[model samples]
Target: MKVVVAGSSGLIGTALVAALRRDGHEVTRLVRRPANARDEFRWDPARADLDERALRGADAVVNLCGAGIGRRRWNGSYKQELRDSRIVPTDVLASAAAAAGVRTLVNASGVHYYGGDSGDRIVTETSPAGTGFLAGLCRDWEAAAQPAADAGVRTILLRSAVVLARHGGMLGMLYPLYFLGLGGRLGSGRQYVPWISLDDEVGAILFALTDDALSGPVNMVGPAPVTNAEFTRALGRALHRPTPLMVPAFALRVTVGEFADEGILHGPRAIPTALEDAGYSFRHPTIGAALAATVGRS
Candidate 1:
């Protein structure tokens, strides 16, 4: 199969491209910079422009383009960056995929589709979208891909969790602090932190690409969801360190603004109902196992 991947420079994108290549699939990177490689093509998401030929003969197009949500404190400008980064590239790709007669479009979405807080309720692919900026952002993000579906293409949304890896994503940010024994849970630490191992994250994308039965929102997370406090304890165990230090909610808000609340302190207890029913086995399913594997890799 031939695949075109946007945001091929990210942590997940980098891993996904390598995995796809390793599996004997032809992959082309849709990059923002100059196309210097044989397998790369330049695209301008800002202008909703991509060479239509890039999509021709492609079996699947995986879009992972977006601004880093936690890169800075959320203000009006950064929030607009968050929304525009996702919606623009997705609109461009969806339009291109439809016109190119692409069979599949595996777009990156998020679990924030379930809202900021779910308390005891566990969300699935079928759950109604929740309220708040992130939830609305996720809703619009997924909506931008509707053109592909309208054109009879199989469109799948990988409603991803906080991806965990030693070198990038959430774990990368936390590993150094944990190594120094200064790591702990955020806020009261009781909120669920839905997560996926980096291996599983890339693997799930591949599964979505080929799994013909799957369409619409598919939660790309572990079967078991752990609370922030539980995750803290498990991560501490993985590093053989104490995790007594805790960051209060107010302190985090002061540091990272609103994301401290919605993105960090509160999260959905989302389950990968679709993945499990599809019999997708996770490489690192448990928090303890995932953390230990992460530390070993470092």
Candidate 2:
């Protein structure tokens, strides 16, 4: 299959591109800079500019465009940046895919679509949209891809979890701290931490690209659910370090502001119901296995 990928420089995007190529799929990458490689094409999502050839004759277009949610303290400006960075590029790509008559449009979203602090309630693809800023952002982000679905193209909204990787992502920020024996739980450590391994994250995208039975919102997360405290312990165990510290909820608010609450202190108990129903298997089904593959390698 011929696949065109946007946001090809991100953590998930990088893995997805390599996986697609390794699996014998022809891949074209959309870059913001000038195109230099045969498989590269330049596109400007902010200006809604994409070369006519970018999506031509493509079987699928996978959009992973979004600013890092936890990259900065949440100010009014940064929040707007998060929305623009995701919704704009998604709108452009979805429109282009529709115009080019692409067969599939796999757009990126987040498990936060179900809102923060889902408590013990299990979230599925059929769950309704939740409240809060992140949920609204994800809701809008997924809505931006409506053009493709309306045009009769099979569109898949990938509501991804916090991706655990060896080098970069959530683990990247925590690896050093955990290795130094300073890792600890945030807040009361009772919030659910929706997470997935980098391998399965990439594998799920590939699976969604070809599985005709899958469409709409699919939760790309681990089958097993773990609380933040459980995650902290698992990560500590994986690194062979003692996690004896705790970051209070007030301190977290003072440190990272609003993100400390929504991004860290709260998360959904999201499960991969759609993926499992579609017969997609996970490489790291448990959090312990996921941390071993990621933190153990590091």
Candidate 3:
């Protein structure tokens, strides 16, 4: 199938593009600059400019384009930036894909859509959206794809969790601390950290594109959920370090304000119900195994 992926330079996008190419699928990347002679195309979501002709023959369009949530603080301006960065690009892409008559549109959402503080309850795709900057952004982000949906395209809304890998994303921020023996549980150490390996995340995206039964919201997370303390322990074990310190939630708030309180230090248990129901298997189901595989400490 011919697939066009936005945010092709991101961690997930890089992995997905490589996997898709390895499988002999024709992949096109959407860039911000003008289209070059290469396989890359151009689209400026802020200006609502896109090369619709490049997407004319696309069988599937995966919109992974978005600003990094963990890259900065959630200030008033940054908050708007975060929201617009995801929604605007989605709106532009969806409109183009719908007009081009694309068959499948897979848009990215976050696990925060289910809210940050989930206590112990399990969340599935059918659950109602939570309230917060991220949840609101995700709600609006997914809603931007309505044009494709109305065009009878199979749209998959991926509610991805913290994607665990070695080089980029969340791991890069935590690896230094873990390697320094300062990594440990956040806050009271009881909050759930719903996570998925990088491989599983890419695989799930491919699976969703091929599976016709999948549409709407799908949680891209591991089967087994781990508490904050458990994740700290597992990561420490993976690095063979003594986790002797705990970053209290109050300290985190004092340091990074609401962002640390909401996005970084807190999360709920999100299970991939739709993926499992679609008969997709997970390579790293548990946190310990995932950490081992990621750090090459096995």
- State candidate 2's TM-score: 0.98
1 against 2, candidate with superior lDDT: 2
Name the regions of candidate 3 deviating beyond 4 angstroms. Answer: none
**Residue 30, candidate 1: alpha-carbon lDDT:** 95
| Full-model lDDT, candidate 1 | 0.91
Clashing pairs in 1: none
lDDT of 2 at 252: 91
Steric overlap count per candidate? 0, 0, 0
Distance from true location, Cα of 77 in model 3, Å: 1.1
The Cα local distance difference test for each model comes to 0.91, 0.93, 0.88
Tally clashes: model 3.
0
